[model samples]
Target: MKAAVLFETGKPLQVVDGVQIPELLQGQVLVDVHYSGLCHSQLAEVRGHRGEDRWVPHLLGHEAVGTVSAVGAGVSKVATGDKVVLGWIKGEGQDVPGARYPLVKDGKEYLLNSGGVTTFSEQTIASENRLVKLPDGMPDKLAVLLGCALPTGMGLVFNEAKLLPDALESQGKSIAVFGLGGVGLSALIAAYTTQPKVLIAIDVEAHKLELAKKLGATHTIDLSTENWQEALQAICPGGVDYSFEAGGKAETIEMAFEAVRDAGGQCIFASHPKEGEMIRLEPHAFHRGKSIRGSWGGGSQPDRDIPLFVELYKAGKLPNLELLLSHEYSLDEINQALDDLEARKITRALIKIAGE
Candidate 1:
């Protein structure tokens, strides 16, 4: 198998060939990867933002779509030839550990490590829990987003915010999303589906903000040019009913929390800062009914939510969802994709592995 291996943290991934795939263990599924989506999590992993690299020389990637070529012992969530969406989020299946691939260097054999799910390779050994069977005829590229971006984004609004399309208040809810990455824009799109009275998108880039508008943001705030709190305040006097933070910064997390209305407003942050980083907030705000919480994959259940997300996309409820994937890079260009993601040059970069 061919794969982009992370030999070291804070370094470029080495696109290597002939990395040997070992026999699948219990609860594992062998997938021929079709497409992978790059997001901030991969950037953080490559940049060593999470503090340590104990998993060096490992496969990197979480969200992807692929075909099941084989199944391991005791695995029954999916079958051979089943098209599936590979994700980091756990679902109902046999829980298992990461896989190790064999690599030969100058006749010296080495082992490459991988998590329960990885996509930056032509083929991967994923735990059954990380696999979600995709429906027949679904676009592989778009389904790639289901693994992470859409699940987390839509989950933030649906699961965390509990904002249902038909349950919106008569006046509608006021919502604000801080950041414009794939996850943030996804939340923005989900929030839009509820017909929110005010949907504000905040970002440092003009292009992302513009895309937010087209995707359904009633207003856009340029963090580089304006104070987001003031801008948000000007748009919604009493603060928004919900604020979602995906900026991956402590300051933004604090700001997102503070932007919520004092009475029953909620703030949910899907991004995490570097390990050991701290976010400070006023404790008194909790007394006034303002609440903040961090989301784990937007509280998504891959097996359950991915199907719903697919249905919504098919129904055209998530209009222009394809626009969220702003760039595509071949598997060989994985390093460049990471660089662009870190530089905030693209909303989402698709990694074309073995997809048609």
Candidate 2:
């Protein structure tokens, strides 16, 4: 198998071929990856934003679509030859440890670390719980999004914020989505279904803002310009009913919190800042019924929520879901894909690991 190995922090991944696949432990499933979605979380790790990288020379990738090639002993959630969506979220299956591979390069032995699931390789040994069987005929590319971006973004709106159908039709309800990445755009798509009178999209990139408008944003704000907050305030004088932060920056998280109305407003941030960075907020805001919270994969249950999301997408509720995928790359071009994501040149980059 060929895998992109992260041998060091702040360095490009080393694409190594002829890598040996480790034997599957109990409750593990071997998958032949077809398409893998490069997420911001992986970028954060590569950039050393998440603190010390103890697991160097490891595989990285959490969302992908693949076919089950084999299952280890005691595994029954998915069978061989089953097309499935692989995610980091834990589902109904036996809990097991991650896989570790021993590779020899230039006569030097190195260990590769990985969680129960990783998708940045032609083949991966994922825990049984990380695999979700896909519906028949589901596009492999689209199903990749269901692993993380769709689940997390849609989960924030449907589960975390608990925005009811009536609230969206209330006319007074307003929503502001900060950052136009895959997760942010997914939130916008989900929020748009509610039909809020005021839907604001904020981003530093003009192209992302333009795309947001076409995807049902009533207003768009470019953060690169000065006084963007003032413009946002003008649109929602009392502040928006809800605000979402997906930029993975502390400053953006603060802005999302401040964009909400002082009373009965909720702010949710799915992205996390680098270690040692903190988001400051007014202590008095809590008294006014304003609250802020972090989301873990939008509190998604892979077994339940993914199927629901598929139904919504098929029903035309999530219009332009494909728009979230901006670029495609081969397994060897993984570094360029990461660069494009960091440069804001693409929303979500899909890496074609193997033919579907």
By TM-score, the best candidate is 1
lDDT of 1 by residue, 21-95 (tens): 899899999999999999999889888999778977889999999999999999988999999999999999998
The whole-model C-alpha lDDT of candidate 1 against the native structure comes to 0.91
TM-score of every model versus the real structure: 0.98, 0.97
Clashes of each: 0, 0
| Runs in model 1 lying further than 4 Å from the true structure | 169-171
Evaluate residue 125 in candidate 2 and report its C-alpha lDDT on the 0 to 100 scale: 94
When superposed on Cα atoms, how far off is each prediction in RMSD?
1.2, 1.5
Question: Evaluated with lDDT, which candidate comes out highest?
Answer: 1
Alpha-carbon lDDT, every model: 0.91, 0.90
Give the alpha carbon lDDT tens digit for every residue of 1-356 in model 2.
89998999989999998788888889999999999999889998888888768989878999999999999999989999999999998988987888988889988988799988899999999999998899864589989999999889888888898764336344446999998899999999888887788999999999999999888899999999857679988999978999988988999999999899987999999997888998899989999989999999999999998888888777778878888888999999999999999888999999999875
TM-score of 2: 0.97
